[model samples]
Target: MTRGLTPSVHAIWQAMGLVPPPGPLGARHDFTIEDTDLILRLAPDGQAATLEGTLGALTPDPHEATAQLRKLLRLGLGLAGFNRAALVLPDVNGADAAGAAALMALADRRPDQPPLRVTAQARIAPGDPRAAVAALEDILQWRSFARDVIPASAEPATAAAHPASPATPPDSGADFVIFQP
Candidate 1:
């Protein structure tokens, strides 16, 4: 059998049959312009692919659901006119070659901008729709001027009740991890 080439941006592009050269990696993550969507994929050692979601459809509100989404999410999604923009948050705790490339892609797209930093506070209110609504408010309150605020909701009893389930714990202190997709 023939030997396979290593996974580089060029190789990935060739694999995708794209003619244009891939851009250098940016602050958020290295992304290649494919059609209308910006794609960032990572397969780091000792770490799962933490960021692997897409931004698309260029909607007034691109969220799959309103309650679970953060209010400031629009800021990130709407920053560019395109319907889809994806950034993969690399696991920087260890080796980050792939992560670095991804970040570089983000930087390329958002030059001179901070790499999508985010901070959030969530509260669980049982049997109260308002709790979810409040969570959105909290996201806006805690959000930095540069970053977008994302409002979320959750149910106290059901694990999935929280509209914004599967959040990266505060302890992780992850700036932004794939936009809660």
Candidate 2:
């Protein structure tokens, strides 16, 4: 049996100095990438990732959303991109790493730039389909400049919607965990 692996990417990336943004301990957190305004959320288990935004320069045509999703997300990054891009570090490899760095640099030089804006047609409006998108994004706050993402330590939620959910590893304490997804 392996003796040095755990299920928490947070623990590993933190050890490697690739920190994510500050978030609640034990509670899954979200990130708003300052460079592109991409909102990323990791699954409760930290194995699956979801990226949401107004669509970037490459995703301008709504018809290309799915293709862009595949292309942009084609990075072999897994949690690496999550830690670096979200935390504003360089990914070891892949387009996202470059994008992450670009965003980080942009954040530094144009610190005042507003969150990357979605196209005009994509704007959320009353009775608009995109309204759902707006609702989802409204929950994210630029607490830390998207590039200011840092290492996260889990804090068990006092109350959870899923009471039987698996507990978050106590800091770096999940020695016996393995993620199948």
Residue ranges of candidate 2 with Cα displaced over 4 Å: 1-28, 32-34, 42-47, 57-181
> Candidates' lDDT values, in order?
0.32, 0.32
TM-score of 2: 0.20
TM-scores of all models?
0.21, 0.20
**How many clashing residue pairs are found in candidate 1?**
31
Q: lDDT per residue, candidate 2, 1-181, as tens digits?
A: 1111122324424543667335443323333333334433443344443334322332222223234334334331342332232212234266565555444434454423222222111112222323323333332322122212211122211212455646775585767757897
The TM-score leader among the candidates is: 1
TM-score of 1: 0.21
Could you report the Cα RMSD, in angstroms, for every candidate shown?
23.0, 23.6
Which residue runs does candidate 1 get wrong by more than 4 Å? 1-8, 19-29, 32-42, 46-53, 56-181
